[model samples]
Target: MLTRSFPRLATLRYPLVLAVALMATACGKGTESTAPAASTPAASTAATPTDTAATPAAATAPAQTRQPGPIVPPQGPAPVLGTDYEEIPGGQPWQPEPGKVEVVEVFGYICPACAAFAPTVEPWHMKLPADVNFHYVAAPFGPEWIPYAKAYYASEQLGLVDKTHMALIDAIHVKKTLPGEGDPVNEQKIADFYGQYGANPKQFLDMMQSFAVSTKINQGRQFMQKSGVTGTPTIIIDGKYRITGGKSYQDVLRIADHLIAMERAAMAGTPAAAPAAAPAAPATGTGG
Candidate 1:
């Protein structure tokens, strides 16, 4: 099980405050990926520029995204510690089981960046090597974001995340069902969206509020805080490294794949693949 930091009451309130500022700062982080880009939801639009040069050709034209890319070996200098990637302070990656490396994505349905990053993450996650274990941790940034996280956790309990993951994003970003801001989340409407996926509205709604799901949400919040994740779409590798190359959404995965290779080798007792030295302090930068 994952560990939590905040007390129950305070944890519930923190997301409301942090979410407000996060949207503003996050605007400066990544590209907004949507059709007829001008109409992109305000929250999902890219507010600032990142290193799009690192965005490979496949990401530029997602039509070819499913084509498997070459599996480059992890060589050359390691990613600059404390810069490219930051280590969690005295923390271990939250692995689900032995024989697999943990990959947790911190995202929010309301985050435009997360919506934009979804396309890249969706196909990429499926192609991951067998030794890597991937996870999605929804950010409970506010009243709007909290409902999505609750829904995601509910899906997790029902073994339906794969079924609902991209569909939720499409409903909001593509169909424009969910508002970007200025309106409270409509639970019934969101429930209706899930209903189409065969989730009984009552059962799904009840699952979201179940004690078990609540605990997972709390644990996710604590994990974000510990790992220096300040926005949607941040990635934590093996609970130790936060991919911070800040190149592009695609670069996030590129760096993560490299880290996975390194971790994989280390697990094999390869002395040449020593882990990066621990950082003196945990990163204070946002995961944007």
Candidate 2:
């Protein structure tokens, strides 16, 4: 069975199953959700009936990622330091720029949890204050993850990230047009995938293997190590804190908002009040 091919995906399946369940609940609540317009045969052989029995939990990937709605700042007390987030000792921004508060996400395109979080985080990131900077650092957890990480940097180099970021996620998770888990990892196939978005396949492949991309991959690896990031969908606030626990993805963003506010205030010379101690929260299942 295809699940046997990538045993590591045991951690990735929970979020996929959860996303599908949430989609069902939203429909029951009378909220209509639209699946992506593009439909293609699933790349995973695991989706076949013969293999589906092995990983029944993740048979149906979420049809629709949660849409961006009104930006409601999380309503609650400030996030507690130890319970909500952890400080990254001696950490520094992945790419520092003066006067901008940096928020970086260490994620993997192949990781289902990161796929689930993308729809939620992308909207929040879009609404960030002008003084705040949001960056994505692709996590290269294994061989299957490296090509997509390279694709990210290459797309970044070609100024295609803004256009292709969400689409790539959709291709991998929803449409399943591109290779993800339980599928052969082909660099050329990934390059051809970008060709549809105006990038020449040959040139995209060259850029993927370029020195600039390699440097970024290495830099991102070192940053994850220093920040003590252990999983995908992990958020880093100003490189000083790595969000460790939250009851939900919303709670994760809520904690991120609190931390961003604190950072914003600190920058303006008006530090926010210390948050009261709260009991430790459950780990938001970030796919390892």
Candidate 3:
């Protein structure tokens, strides 16, 4: 017969053994942040568990990306049509008369607006069709405007305009340098710049002061006065329309296009296609 074992002692012994085993395992491991080395093969083979929640949260987060849509341009006031100044019909608006469809740009060198308009008009000049004749009328509005006009004619006479025209604009607008005001328009200064274009200094001066050149300048002044242009950068199209402000530049071109089509129609002796009847009376007015 075996001695009787206490049931409570048996139960307590297993719990005590478990506590000691856990305490021994913990004590064996140091308080450092590193994980304990795996001893058993199965423990080594198993993957170490990770929080994993942080990775999915990080991956699901939105990325920094650009917004999608068509980019809109800055808005400004709509362009106005014509000025309040005197209206001179370019004389038979659509006809291609001797001086008709003449695009006369009344400009003064000292005027910054004239300088700005120079480049815009250049390309238009190159591509101008046969019906449209373009010209630059040096506006002799004052004593200051006269010399620059003379310089312009001088450049024309010497056949040096293609080289010097843009240079003059750049000199005034970009470089902030004035060629000074006087009769004969200071050939030496222009020569200094134009010599780069193979123009002789003395010859350039002589032609600039010649009677022929002076006559051309007078003609330009007369044209401006006749056109009733009191301000510069006025674009006189077909000797029938005048565009004064910067806004008018494009309108002037548009009018020119219209006039060109009209001219072609008149030449072909064919009527333009009629438009759909309108509900209200349409605005009938002349534009540059």
lDDT winner, 1 or 3: 1
Q: Which ten residues in a row have the lowest lDDT in candidate 1?
A: 1-10
Report the CA-based lDDT of candidate 1 relative to the real structure: 0.60
User: For candidate 3, lDDT tens digit of each residue in 1-288?
Assistant: 000010000011111232232222110110111212211111011111121121111211222222322312213322233421123655323223652345566666655434434444565565666555666777554444566677788877777666667667566445635452222345477656666677787776676678998888766756655665544455655655554322233434444454444444555678953312224657797777
CA-only RMSD, every prediction: 10.8, 12.1, 37.5
Native-to-model Cα distance after best TM-score fit, residue 181 in candidate 2, in Å = 1.5
Q: Quick one: best TM-score, which candidate?
A: 2
lDDT of each: 0.60, 0.65, 0.45
Best by lDDT: 2
RMSD of 2: 12.1
How high is the lDDT of residue 112 in model 1? Answer: 50
How many steric overlaps does candidate 1 have?
Answer: 3
Question: Which residue runs does candidate 1 get wrong by more than 4 Å?
Answer: 1-72, 75-77, 273-288
Q: Give the Cα-based TM-score of candidate 3 against the true structure.
A: 0.56
- Over 69-172, each residue of candidate 2 has an lDDT whose tens digit, in order, gives 44344467787767678888999999888877899988777665566566666767877777778899986656667789899999998878777777787777
lDDT of 1 by residue, 83-198 (tens): 56777885666546787888988877765556556667778877777777788998775666667788888887777777777767666655667644335668777777788878
In model 2, the number of clashes is 0
- The alpha-carbon root-mean-square deviation between model 1 and the true structure, to one decimal in Å, is 10.8
